[model samples]
Target: MFGGVTIGEFARLTHLSVRTLRRYHESGLLAPATVDPDSGYRYYTADQIPTAQVIHQLRELDVPLADVAKILATEDAEERAGLAGEHLRRLEAELARTRAAVLSLRRLLRPHDDTLRVELRKIAARTVAGIEDVVAQDDVLSWYDEAMAELDAAIESRPLGPPGGRYANELFTDGRGTVLVYRPVADPPVRGRVHPVHLPPSELAVVVHPGPHDDIGVTYGRLGAWVVDHALAVDGPVHETYLVGPRDTPDPAAWRTEIGWPVFRLAVTDVMPGKNPGQTGNPPP
Candidate 1:
């Protein structure tokens, strides 16, 4: 005790509580300078003041206790900086998501009466020459770039139809993204690694998106609402028929994607089925 500082006095000087100091000792983060054998009392020297203050600053930055212990165990400057840099990137991504949510809420609250035009259309079957892949939703953008490059090399003539995306059942429920590119032509070859998928006949609730793909979620919500109002339910994954893409159109403002929700006629009857003797569809036990 160079400055005559006891454990309690040292905690006050370092802006740390007595309980916290004791916990740090147990965690091997910071240990006291001296300890009594028989009395079991703890004491600290003035030189340990800087160590206590450093721990205080680190805890204030939201660093986990385990990570703080690792930082103290290693003396490598580069490794410590690397950990901090990774945490900073995660914080930035979280902030961006929070900002996007705020903007969406603001858009919903604004007064507007721009009614969306709902159309029921039948899509004809056409041959497309492009690449297809199963991609994770988070990595879909990068996958699209690679697939487009393959399409450009495989196809001799330029794409006649728009670039589009096809979703499978697992896409929405499990976050699995399946994308397919289509080019219109007669008797397209289905050889090499390309797989041919036929477009099924069904009633589709179609809406034309007139801008970029940034806020496509807004259009999806509006279309679903329309389908609900008409007592129509979608039984399949949604499909986006891109009328314009980077290869066909240079201006993003002119880009168009025909978003279609597959739906069918609901058969309503005034008949009810008899309950089984042992099973009455009761709530689970």
Candidate 2:
């Protein structure tokens, strides 16, 4: 400890715990400028304060320990800044997700009166271009993005109707299940992974989920309760129609999704099944 300050002063100056400095020592993220062989004391040079502060800031941002080490080891100032910047972007994304979750929780607890609006309609049988896959619940978003992109590329013509997806209950219950995404095209052309999917005539209890899909679960829960209260029995996979979404618009506030449950005794006026199921519409029952 001859050339550098004692660990006690270093801790006070850096505002870090003595134990933390020792841990950082063991982890090799920060090393003492000198160590006394006889007394086993650690010492850090005054110049090391800025590096310690940087490590503290990075740790506060939740950067991984390995990344912190890599950043500290970087010699070029620009390269170090770039590494830290990348982690900042990731932290920003995490903060956005956290904010979304908080807003969803607030809406769930408030229970909006208009959130329960339900529309019962008859959907006729039809064939559409689709891509099907068995995806884990966590992977659904990414898989949907890729599938929808493929569907869009294959079906260059304007969609006859909004794109839709059929999700099996097992996707939520057991965490993995079949998910089918389809675009209503006048004539479904099969190419690569795209296939013509035949949908059956179904009576749906539908509800509109407004805004970003982050809180769509809230709308889904309310719709399920409505179905139960109305004595409607869910008979098939849940249907989700993207009336307005990322593919059509960049603004999430303008996105509108239809959550439909194919149900029995849905109180919908009957309609004939045909190739174009969308033509079948009944007054909201």
lDDT of 1 by residue, 114-218 (tens): 566667666776556656778787777677777667665656655556666667667666888666765554445565645455666666778887766656677
TM-score of candidate 2 versus the correct structure, residues matched by position = 0.73
Over 4 Å off, model 1: 1-103, 190-192, 248-251, 267-285
What is candidate 2's lDDT per residue for 1-285, written digit by digit as tens? 178888889999999989888888898988999999999899899999998888888888988999999999899999999999999988887887897788789987884675366777789899999999899998998899999999989997788999999999999999999999999998898898999999989988888898998788878888887777656788889999999999889999999999999888744334332334333222333
- Every candidate's lDDT: 0.69, 0.86
Question: Clashing residue pairs, candidate 2?
Answer: none
* CA RMSD per model (angstroms): 11.6, 6.6
Among these predictions, the greatest lDDT belongs to: 2
